[model samples]
Target: MNFAAAVSVALNALRVNALRSFLAMLGVIIGVGSVIVMISISQGAKAAVDAQISALGANSLQLRPGSSFRGGVRGGSGSATPLSDEDVEALRETVPYVIAAAGIIQQRGLTAVVDGVNWSTEVAGTHPDYFIVRDWDIVEGRAFTVPELDGAARVAVIGRTVANELFPAGGAIGASLRISGVPLEVAGILAERGQSSWGQDQDDVIFVPATTMRNRLGGLSTAGVRNPVQSIWLGIDRARNMEAATEEITDLMRVRRNIRIGGTDDFAVVNFAEFLRARNETESQLGLLLAATAVISLVVGGIGIMNIMLVSVTERTREIGLRLAIGAKQADIRNQFLIEAVVLCVAGGLVGMACGAIGALVVESMGQFPVSIEPMIAFVAIGAAAGVGILFGFYPAHRASRLNPIDALRYE
Candidate 1:
């Protein structure tokens, strides 16, 4: 039989048992839908993470006290000891690739008061270079001057959140606010930087001079050393050189800290690029698992189609025998069944694609997750559906083709 005639026969068969064909296609619908939804969610999560990381600035590397991978505590050994002004200066003078570095000391429970309104916030003690490294912009007034950092002046910059909390009607700059009971003048108000994906408010802190934090707020202590600096922030000339610069800094610190060759370095260095890559890998793995689960449903659906097709062959035995008597070849009978199976799957796939799109939109609306339906994903799903039909339809088609013409004609 020709392609058109085979398709017509397949369509007529499915039309005679509309409900059964629909049922057979149900599994494909579910499988395709699940894959699309899972992939969309994963992509959304990755996008959010990437956005947060990008907000941290490009070519940035964070040097914290402990090893990020192994250290249980942030301030523990095997992490770098509290970064200091001396370390910052050494990096500036010695490392040509290093563009800027800032020592940071973080102190929570710092209270900011303006008039009667009071807000407790985290205060980061850092130098003027921190602004450059962090890519933070001042909306009002200016960052603390070099002279102020050198003199350990009690000056502070308030984040947008802190500014709003302290001075709700604006005009908080040049105002004096007490940090840990010590008075400091608010020199600048940072522009709004929204909340992070982890739900932490990024703009709810205060910035101060590193010197003032050490002198007044005291230093962070771990195992009783009173380590002053919590971490160091560095910006390199190029992001591509982040790894090389990180290694160079580690070597320099190891020598400066007198760490033996066999001993593990106490400080931890983190690159955002590494973090992003690891996150992407994790997302991809999860996506594959979800897609596999959906594919399993498709296989089950295919089995259903096969079962129905076998029954169909048995029910239409007499018709097959009559067609064979009227010059229909075994090949023609086989093609008819095959086309019917393919039609069932293709139709189901189209319907499944539509359902998947609607489902994605619903998820996006309800969960507020960004859902992206790539055209490639849709095409893959459609192709898989068709493949399932062919794979499952083959056995039944072969069985029908091999049936004895004499027995089929004699069936009651």
Candidate 2:
């Protein structure tokens, strides 16, 4: 028989045992579907992590004071010692790579009252240049003026979450909001920045001038340190400048704070570049592990296909004998069986592709994690499924081809 006729015959044979054929292909369907879903979701996670890491800006650094060793009971960075405005100035003067720096003071449990609607949130006090250090954009109105930041103006910039909660009806810009009984003008509304990598909400706070927070809200005091602010933020001129800037800033903080050499640092300077690299590496490793799991499933699916094809050969002994008796060559029988196996796998692959797409969509709608479909992934899955069929189906096809015509005919 010709190639087309052999394919037609093989298809008819599958059609005759429709239930068995469907059962045989089930493994391939599951294997391909799982692989596609796993790959797409892993890739999406990697992309999301990278994007979020970049949100912090590659050249940014956060400086926080170290422990104070008060009464032999030491607490961590935030309350140990307070960073001052002088530190910010010294960083600018001493470090050439440090372009801009700002002092930040945080006050939590501040109640913001707007038209009798009160919401409790944390407040941040920083210079006007803090926005530049953070690479933040003011979506409405404008950023604080130098006069506002320097002279303790009662103007505040609110984050997206704060605005949405305080002014559900919209129009947050230029609104008057009272914070802890102190009325402050809303100078700007920040754009939405959903969440941090550590799952903290980024848009749930307010930004006021450092002077305003100190004077109006009362300066934050620490156990051992006389005056304290939460942390200092700095922006380097370039990504490559982080290492040198960190060293210089550390040295300056050491000398300024009177920290002795061979002793622990009195302050912490955190460079975000190292964090970015570590995050990317983590994502890549996670993707590789998931990909390995997917490959293992495919291998198991291939084994299932082999088992079913072998059973098929045993059940079709008389049919093979009859074909051989009709002057059909061994190669023709082999080709016919191989075609049948390939068709089954290809059909399973198609169905699996559809299942994978549906799974991805369902997962995405749940909003728990990121999932993005890459079309090329589906094609690769289908090709692998086809390869599975060819590899697993060969042995069964060979056995059928080598069968003795006389013995096959006499079998039950």
The number of the candidate with the highest lDDT is 2
Error of 1 at 270 (Å): 3.2
Alpha-carbon runs more than 4 Å astray in model 2:
1-9, 69-75, 222-228, 237-241, 271-291, 317-332, 360-370, 401-412
TM-scores for all predictions: 0.76, 0.84
What overall lDDT, based on C-alpha atoms, would model 1 receive against the true structure?
0.81
lDDT tens per residue, model 1, 1-412: 6899789989998998999889988887887777677767767767777777766867788877665333454444545445667778888788777888888887777677767678988988888888888778888999998898878898889899898888887777777887657888889998788986568898999988877777776645555344356778888998778878999999888887678889777777788767876877887787778778888888887888888889899999999888887888999999999888889888888888888878888988897776777677778778988898899999999888887888888888
Worst 10 residues of 2 by lDDT: 219-228
Top candidate (TM-score): 2
Q: How far in Å is the alpha carbon of 57 misplaced in model 2?
A: 3.5
Give per-residue CA lDDT, model 2, range 114-216, as digits (tens): 9999899989888887888888889998888878877899999999999989999988888999987899999998878789878888899999988888889
